[model samples]
Structure formats: C-alpha cells, structure tokens
Target: MLDIAKLAGKIPGISHHFQQEMTASSQRLELAKTILQQAQNQQEALIERYQTWRDRLIFSAAMPVEPLDTRITIVPPPHRHSVFATDGSQIAPSHHEIAYCYLINVGRVMLHYGQNLHPLLDSLPEVYYRPEDLYVSRQWGIRTEEWLGYRRSVLEAQCLADMACGWVNPPGAHHEPNLAMVDGSLVYWFLDGLAHDARDLILVPIQEAWEQLKAARIPLMGYLSASRSVEGVNFLRLHNCTFDTPNCIMNCVDVEEQQIPCKVIEPLRDTTLWGENLQPGQRGPLWQSSARILELYDEAQRIYFCYVNVGTEIARIEVPGWVAEDQDLFNQGLGIMLAQVNKGFGYPVALAESHNQAVIRGGDRIRFFALLEQQMIRAGLQNVGTSYKEARKRGSIA
Candidate 1:
C-alpha cells in the first residue's frame, strides 16, 4: 500500500517542478504558433521546400496534402447512414498459468442512423494454445506478448472489414452510405525492427482487409483521441531550420551547445498546435505520414491523417490513400465521424460501445484461468497446475 502521508509531503515539490515545466511549455507553444502562422502564409514555398528536403530529414513528419491553413467545418452527416466499428482485448500467454495460451476477443458493432434496423453488437473470442499459434519464431527472440499484440490488431481490422463487407452486400439488396472505424492507428508501426518475413505475416492480412474495404468502396477510418503525435510539429521544425541546406546530423549543433536552433519549439505536439487553432467541428488539412514502415505498405494503402476539434478533445483521424484521394468519400467520412462524436457526446459512439464489449476485467481473467484448470482436470490432465508464484498471488498471507 502507498503511504499517503509521505506522498502528500512530496506534492509541493512535484507541483513546483510541474509549474516550471508548464511555464517552459507555454513559451514553446507560443513559438510553435508563430511558426505555424508563418508556414500558413508561405504554404506554397513551404511545400516546395518540403518536397525538396523531404528525403534528407531524419525524423518522421507530415507531408501536406492540402493548403497548410485549410480548416473545413464539419458538414452534417447524411440522414441515413451506417457506422461499423471494432475493438479488441487480449489475455496474453502467461508462464505462471496452467495453460500456455492466449485469447483475443474482438467486439463488433454496427449502428444505423435514421433507419429502423436495430444496432448489432457482439463479440468474437478465439483462444490459441497450439505451439504454432503461441510462437512466431522462438529462435528469433520474438516475444509471445509482442506477437499476440500484432495478432490482436490484425484481428480487429479483419473483423471490421468483414462486417463492413457484409453490410455493403447484404441479402436484402438494401444499401446505405457507411463508414468503418477502428479505435487506433491503422499503421503497423510495431512491425519496425522485425524481420521482413515477420512483417509480411502481419501486414499481409491487414492489407487484404484494407483491400476488401477499398474494393467495396467503403471508407475506413482510424480514430485516435488526445493524440500526442509530433508529425506536424516536426514539419514545422523542418521549416524553421536556419541552415541554407539543412542536414540534421551535421548542422544541428550550435556554438554554445545550448539547444538546436530549429528546436526552439521543442515538445509541442500536433494536438497542441491544432487544439489552439481549430474550432469545434473544424478539421485541419490532411497530411500524409512519413513513417519509414509505410514503405512496406502498398501505395494505395499508405496512411493520411488530419486533426479535428471534437468539442471534448482534439482527435487524429487517419484514412488510407484511396479514401483521401476520393474527395466525396473523404468529405462523407469526415462528416459521419463528426456526427458520430456529437451523438456520442464527444466520442465516437460505435467505438465506445465496441470497447465496452471488448474490455476484459481482472475478475474475468481470474475466472478464465480457473475455468481452464477445471477443464484440464476433466480432460484427465492431472499435471495441470499453476506456478507457485501464481498460487501465492491468488491468496497472499498477511
């Protein structure tokens, strides 16, 4: 147990330190805003400069797809439309458990607005105990937890895609404008540093799902709430670099070694930059991601994102290249998102419902292990037993 009195005694010093940090952050924010305004005015020139120096920059930044200062108000969604969303939770394989297995539960939701059809909400849970399922390559040092996480993400996307495809080609011959949403980034950033074969194992399935959505002409979105992404801020730093021919590694140092000149606005995130400027229901310009991992993705599957003010918080909305390139679909998708957030009272209702369906509480985990052990015993597996540490943890002695 924590000692509240001891923690209380340290509060003043912690507060003082936080206050100083906030002061510094405020200064940086001002500088960031100034640089943003300047970039907006010279949008064309900045775009050219970005195009010229993009290959030389070491950090990932946003590549503008629209005018830098563009801010579009959210149009009301169509009277009749559908939104499908999916979220996932997992029970990672634990060494202390009786069984070396993991389970992934994907919550699926379909909501129809201005239609009589009832919302569809359900979950699909799958357990993997086989050696092949439990390990990608034990010899390669790929941890089970990491592989499970990647598999979970892939399952979520695949489930969402399956639902959207079914909705698009229903048996009744009735169709409506629809959007598919996932709770987080679509980019497989976790594939970084993994071997090419491992990357393909994950990306292939996701890309197939993405292809299905695209082939059906269904728009898919990845919603990130309170995003701390610095892609946009990094772009600003690139623009603010004073060197005639900017080379990050060679020219970033100053004589006094105080700070990198271009980093005057250090620590400001894309959220802070947009939250300060974007009004409720307004979205900033679309920007393509410069992540290195995206090189592995098909050209049409590349990610593009924009920041939107959803009244409660700044949200980062990402879409595939196909969606971004299609103006009508992009507009429709954005409007649908805004409407969903408004209806949900500041967050996407579909995502929230799906999350509720996906979340697995601690008590549920305990019960799962207990059930597993019981089933093993019934199967005549007398060797089944939890590790000593796990047994002690269940009922600790005072």
Candidate 2:
C-alpha cells in the first residue's frame, strides 16, 4: 500500500497552496474596493439604463438596481418555527458494474425551535434500472451526463416538495412557521442551453414542486454558499456609456481615449459587494435572476435571489418570484433561514445533516457490488466480470 506517512509529509505544500490563494484573494479585494467607490451616487443612473437595455444585455447580467444599505445587524430568530432541509446524492451508472443502473438518495432533516429544540432525520433511496429510466435524450440519440444531472435535479426538488406537502401541525395544537430549503439555485441553471421541449422534462417537475409547496403553505428556498455570481456587478455594467449609442458595441470600445465606462466595477461578482456590506442576519435586496432560462418559466415560478450574510460567508438564497412578491411569506422565509444559519454555526444545520445522510461511502459501494454478485451466483447466472483495470486493482498486492 502507499505510505500515508509520506502523504502527511506534503502538508507544507498544501499550506503553500492555501497561502497562494489567500494572496490572490487579497488582490481581488482591492479591485472590489475600487468598484464599490465608483458605484457611489450612480444607482439611479444604473437603474435607468437597466430598464432601457435589459433585453439587450447579456443573459448573465443583473436586472434593475434595488438600492439597499451596505450593512445591517443580524435579525433575531423567531421564537417558534420549523425548518426543513433536503439534499440528494447519486451513484451514476458505471459500465464496469454488473447492473446497468443508478441510484438517487435523498436525505431530509426537520428542526424545531421553541419550547424545545429537536431534530428529525430521514433518508430515502430510489434505484433505477429500467431502460427508459436509465437513459434519456431519445431524440438526441444518447443519454449524456447532462441529462443525468438534470434528472438528479428534478428528483431532489421532488423529494423535498413531497416532504413539504406532507408536513403537519405539531402535537397539542402548537403552531409554528414552516419553511423548506434546498441546496442550490431555485432556477435550473443549465436550462439556458436546452431546447424548450427537453427543458420541460426538468422544468415541469420543479414547477409542480413549487406549486405543491405553495399549496401546503410552506415557503421553499434554495440556498447557496460561496456564491460568485455577478448579478450586482452586471447591474452597474448596464450604466456603461455605450448603452444608448446606436453603433456602440456595448463594450465601451468606441470611446475616443479608451475611456471605458464602468471600468471600476468590471468583472466582480455580486457576492463581493454583498460581503463588504451585509452583516450577519442581514441580506441584500432581492433581484430576479437574469439567466436566459427564466424566460421559459412562468412569472409565478421565475427565480428571485438575495445575498445573506451567514456570519461565516455571504450566501445567495433563491426563491420563486411569487414567494418574493408575498411580503409576509418572504419575511417569514428570511427569518427561518437566518435562524437556521445561527443554529448551524454559519450554515443551515438541516442541510448539512441531510447531506451527511445522503452521501454514499466507498465501503457502501463495495458492499453493494458484493451483494449484486451474490444474487447473480444464486440465480445460476454468470457474473459480469469487472474491467481488467478494476480486477488488477482488486487483486494487486501493492
């Protein structure tokens, strides 16, 4: 076997790598500082340009400016509430494995805070081996990793939504705000590249999930930590000098002296701006996602997001436009999310717990294959041999 001691000796190299990244991050901070300074007093101008050139702007750009204070203290959690979080994991089909199949495992955690703090955990696994379930993209002639990813996304949403739909009041008539959270963007970020029909395969289920949650009177949110999206920066970019010119390239290239408008705010992600401004329990103003896929969704399901300072990191939290438009639901959702963050030490405990439950470990995979092999032997069927490379790895002495 390889010497783990030798691997431990590489700690210095890892530390060096960490230092290198921190140095680059410091450089980025200087650039971001310059951008924030240049954005001063220009919010209204940027908002105007956004209204005029929104459709013409890049799909990845931000919408109109929603003015918000740079910093605010964390809001205290509601005394009584229930928070539900779900996360899913998958074992992609492998040709070398005996079974031509895949599995998606979803984990859920429900946390209650009030008279007593407690948590309930559950995990569900679904296996797919049927030809139709194993492969997608019939029109395109082959199932790709992209299709599999999309399937997993749909399953994840469905699992959480189903759970939310079944939630009920606590014992003895105690009532509390109920909220559900998922671990990604509310928008299907990959749909921009898909045809309408193909996109619908994934979008329909997600829309149904939203409707189910809404009908159950539960607010659903998608939470993302370490977000680097440029929604805020792109909004400022709309205020570029080329926005109104007939022949302008929208890149400020035609200016006589190369006087690039919005130069200071160029290439910075919205997280940096929010990170500099928001305090724990505080969030940036909500803005609609500018992703091209939003056009495919109805207004009720269109995605909206805001950046929340979770004490440890600036996280982007997304919800449907309908949720954002509801003043009461929106505030309650925010409160529950922040409360979970506080309880989890800068992250949502329920999501973290669910992820832990859903992960498939190496030993588990080995046991799964062993079980499959045993079943084949009992049925008097020849076992599908593993690839030569895999066999060698299993039999090798060193």
Candidate 3:
C-alpha cells in the first residue's frame, strides 16, 4: 500500500519544482520558435549549408523533403473508403509460472465507411514454448523479451500486409480507396544493438512484408500520438550552429569556453515546434529519418515522417519512401487517417478496436496459467507448481 499522507506532504515541493521547469520550458520554446521563423526566411541558405555539412553532423536529425515551413491541409476522405489496422499484445515469459513460455496475440481490424459499413475484428494467438523459439542468441546474452518484441512487430506488419493485399485483390473484384496503419514506428532502430544474424532474422521478414504492400499498391502508415521526436529540432540546431565548419566532436570541445552554441535549442521537440505553426487537420513538411539502421533497409522501404495536427494533439505519421514519393497515394493516405481520427474522436477507430481485440486482461492471464498447469498435470507431470514468490504474491498475510 502507498502512504498517501507522506506523498501529500511532498506535493508542495513537487509543485514548486514543476512550476520552475515549466517557466524554463516556455522560454526555450519561444527561442526555438524564433529560430524556426528565421530558418523559414533563409530556407535556401540553410538547405545549402545542410548539404555541405551533412556528413559531419553528429546528431540524429531528419533530412527535409520539402520547404521547412510547408503546411498541407488534410483534405476530406472519400465517401467510401476502408481503413485496416493491426495491433499486438504479449504475455512475457515469467519464471514464476509453471511453464517457461510466452504468448503473442495480434488483433486485426478493418473498418469500412460510406457504402459498406461492415467492420471485421479478429485476433490471432500464438504460443512459443520451444527453446529455439524463445532465444535469439543465448551466447550473446540477449534477453528473451527483446526477441519476443521484435518477433511480434514482424508478425503485426506481416498481418497488416496480408489484410491489405486481400482488400486490394479481392476475389469478388470490389475495391475502394484503403489505407493500412500500425501502432508505432516503421523504423527498427532497436535492431542496431543486436548481433548481425539476429538483426537480419527480424529485418528480412519485415522487408518482405513491406515489399508485398508496395507490390499491391497499398498505402501504409504508422501513427504515433503525442510524439516527442527531436529529429526536426536537431536539424534546426545544425542551422543555428555558429561554426564555419561544424564538427561536434573536436571543434566544439576545443573552444575555450567549452559551451556548444547550438545547445540553446536542444530542449525542444518537433511536436512542440510544429504545434504552434500547424492548424487543425494540417500536416507539416515530410522529413526522412537519418537513423543508421536505414542503411540496411531497401531504398524503397526507408522511413519518412511528418507532424500532423489531429485536433487533440500533434501526431507523427510515418510512411515508406514509396508512399511518400507518390503524391496521390500520400494525399489519399493522409485523408483516410484524418477521417479515422474524426470518427474515433481524436484517435483512430480501427486501431482502438484492434487494441480492444488484442488486450489480455489480468483475469485472462490467471486463467491461462491455471489451464497450463492443468494440462501439464493431465500429461503425467504431477510436479507442476508455481514459484514460492508467485504463491506469496497471491496470498499475503498481516
């Protein structure tokens, strides 16, 4: 149990600290906005400088695909369109349980508006108990949870691709403007930490799914709400630097004062900077990511992102290079996304429904362990039991 009285006594101090932080944040935001406006005024010079200093940049910034200040209004979606989404939930392998296994449940949803209003909702559950399935590389000290997460992401992408392909190449020959969406980033930056073989094991399947979607001409996007991404802000820092030739490693430290000039606007995020400029239902300029992992991805599957105002908050929408390069597909994809958010009231309806389908509640987890123990006992394994710590958690004594 929590000590409410003790926590309440610290509230005043916490509030004071929060107020001080907010004041500093506001001042930094103003400075960042001023720099943004200046960049807009001298866009050409900054672009040229970025081209010259691209190789020396140490920060993970975004490469601009359009004018820095460009804002495109999201047009209304077509009367008859479909949105397909997939989300996943997992039960991580627990040592306290009777079995050393994990389960992944992927929820798939397809919502149709206008002419056809049929909505499809389903989930696919898979259990991994084999030693080979549970480990990426035990010698490399990789955790099973990390491997599970990557596997789940790959499954979600493949599921979305299969659904989109079915919609595009329907047996009945019915087609409509459709958009495919996933919950998070399309870029697998986390894979950079893994060994080469393990990373390739995950990337190959994801790339194949992307290829399937591209071949089917289906537009796909990943939506992130309340994004705190700093890609654009870091780009601004490069522009704000005072050095004739930027070298963050050696030259910045060699300065007598040891103070980096571009660090002034380092506290800002892309969402905060764009929120002040973009109106409701408008999207800021698209920017390609400079993540190192993209070098391994196919050229067509490289990720690009844009900040969009979905009325409630600024969201980051990510798409593959192919979708971003096609004007009609890009417009259609954004339109469908906006319409979905309006229907769900600030969230995408298909994603929300898919989450509902995928969620595994506490009661479900308890029952799953119970069933596993029962099956084990029925199979002549009478020693099946939970760990002492798990048993103690279930029954506490005063």
Candidate 4:
C-alpha cells in the first residue's frame, strides 16, 4: 500500500535493514540451540569421567605392601626397670597448625603419640623478609629461585637435626630414658649437612656424638617403616628377600639372609587387605609394589613395629649393613614416609591421647631388645661393653 511504501522511503535503508536483521536473528537462534545441546553432551561426559575416577578409588585396594609380622622382634623390658618410649611430630599449616607427637617404647615398638600442639604454625613469629635476605630477589630481567631453594634446604636440614635431638631424650624423663625408639635410622645427625664454616661446626659435634656413642657402646639404628611404595619396594628388591614365612614369624629370622644393613619390608598386607585396581579406580596414597603400578588407591594399614630391648642402650638403628650413600635423600624420604604412615595406620584416638599410652602385651618387651641386638650386629659395630646381663653386674645405665 501507499502507507507502507511511504514509511520505508522516510528511513534511509531502514526498512530493508530491519528485514535483513530479523532473518539473521532467526538463524542465530537455531545455531544457539545446537551449541547448547553440544555443551550438555560435553558436561555429561565430564561427569561420567569424574564418577568413574571416584568409584575406582573408593571400591578397590589397588596397592598392597609387604608383610611386617615378626619383621621386628621386641625384647621385653625387665621387671626391675621401667620401660620408656618417645617420638615427635612437626606442626605446619598443611595440618592446620598442629604439632604432631610421635612415640616408640623402650621395647622399640614404633607407635604414634596422638598428642598435638594447637595452632601449628601459629606459634612461629611472623617471618619478615629482611632487606639483606632479599639481595637476590631478582636480577635485571633474570628469574631468581634462590630463596625457595635456600629455604627448602634450611628447613629440611633443621628438621632432620630436630629429629636427632628429639630422640636423644623424651621430654621430662628427668634423666635419660631407659630406651628411646626414634623414627627412621638411629645414626645421630652428626655428620650430615655442612657448608664452609658450618661444615666444621657440624662435624665436630657429630664426631663428639660418635665418640660418645662409641664409648657408651649404645646401639644406634635406623628403622625402615614398612611401606609398599617405590623406595620400600626397591629397598627390599635390592636385597632379594620377603617376609620369612611360617616358622620365622615367632623368632628373628636372619636379616643376614640378605646380608646387608638395610631396612626390610615387613609383610603387613595379604590377599584379604590387597586387591588389584581395575580401570574403575582412582589413585590414592597406598603403597604400591610396582613403579608403573601407581596405586589406584591405598589403604593406610597401621601396624605395630616392635622394639627389641636387649635391656641395654646397645641396640640397632641402622639395619646393620651398607647404608645408602645418599644420606640426605634417604633420611628425608624415610621421615616423610613414617609420618604418612602415622597419619594413616596408627591407632585411632578421638580424645587427647596421652604420650605414655602403652598397653603391654605378653612379655614381648624382650622382642624389642632382641631387634636391637640384631640391629647392632647388622651395623657391623663390634661390641665392647659389659652386656645387659653384665650392665646390671656393673651398675651403670639402668
């Protein structure tokens, strides 16, 4: 009609442009519907993948570590003397600022003390980055990772040193503990970590400790916490051994069977506690026997490790054989593993657990002493003192 023509004519290309826009809009609407459908499909696929991962992790045991039964024999403590145990845990932010308290008995049974410090890193002074410390924060257009590296080393070394002292005496023992079972190895951190002037300082004290240990002839040994993970599997595989079956369970089998002073895996898992991770599994912290064999999932199987108290300080910490040349790596690795195991398999407590939470079983305190004797022999340390039978004969250390 004339009215429609006139309206179109009044606008410059308006009527024609509006018509084109409406058609384009219709096409866009159809395209949007297709895109939405595709997105929904992708979303469903992702959800399925996640559900599969969670299902695999929840329903399977994936990794099973070796057994630990009779791997350590605790020598029962004599009735005449009191039994003592000690262990410690560090407080950090990852644990929401709680200090972990770890313990082991005079019998050398490795156990966790559930007591902890509140507000973990809360006690530390707010660390300030001093001007002097920032000398290498960065250089013109260059990346400087020095602070992170330096700090990491400092922290690690300090922790190892702290562990050494923590084991030296349990808090408030008034005098030396009848025996202190520490985590990992018993070789005190005398010879570890030194640079330039610090080297001499570290060595001097270490030498003094060595001499003291030598004089006292006290047994210092490292404990290889049982794990089914990479390092543990390799360590045992290196020696070509497994849990000595059936008969060896009640007595100390020859660690000399492998003929090395190294920590051995105690068979702590069996067919019942272990299962394969089918594709429907997710990964977890459980120790695995294979390298490519990532733990589809892991169960924290807390086990009771024994302390063989031969009724004397002369005992074993090193498995009485050739230790790793990489001392730093070995020490750090072992400590972390022990802590993880504690977080997992150790006894569960809901309340504030006491440090001396010990339930004596059998006369097995001697098993701790026996393990100590074996450790001493493995370390190739020649004994010189009056034996425990003779220590009471001499009336020296109780």
Candidate 3 lDDT by residue in tens digits, 1-398: 99998899999999999999889888989999888888877776766777787677777778788998899999988788888899999999989899999999999998878865678899999899998898645756788888788889989988999987877786665477889999888888788877888888889998899888888777899999877789898888776788788767666766544367887866778898899999999999999998877988999999999999999999999999999999888999999999899989999999999999989899878898899989999999977989999999999785
TM-score of each: 0.96, 0.85, 0.95, 0.24
Q: Which sections of candidate 2 miss by over 4 Å? A: 1-45, 70-74, 115-118, 141-144, 169-174, 246-260, 395-397
Better of 1 and 2 by lDDT: 1
Whole-model alpha-carbon lDDT for candidate 1: 0.88
lDDT of each: 0.88, 0.74, 0.87, 0.29
Q: Residue 197 in model 1: shift from native, Å? A: 0.7
Question: Residue-pair clashes per candidate, as listed?
Answer: 0, 1, 0, 58
Candidate 3 vs 4: which has more TM-score? 3
lDDT of 1 by residue, 81-102 (tens): 9999999999998898899899
Candidate 4 per-residue lDDT over residues 1-398, each given as its tens digit:
26887787778788789898777655644443343234334443433343344332212221222222112222222222111122222211111111111112211122223223121110111122343333333432212232333332233223333333444445663222122223343322322332434334333443344333223322222343332222222222212222232123232244453452222222222210111211111111222222221221112211112122222211112321111222332233233323323333442111012122222233433343445457667777675233455345445553
Off by over 4 Å in 1: 253-257
Better of 2 and 3 by TM-score: 3
lDDT (0-100) at residue 221 of candidate 2? Answer: 89
**Which of the two candidates, 2 or 4, achieves a greater TM-score against the reference?**
2
Candidate order by lDDT, decreasing, is 1, 3, 2, 4
lDDT-superior candidate, 1 or 3? 1
On lDDT, the leading prediction is: 1
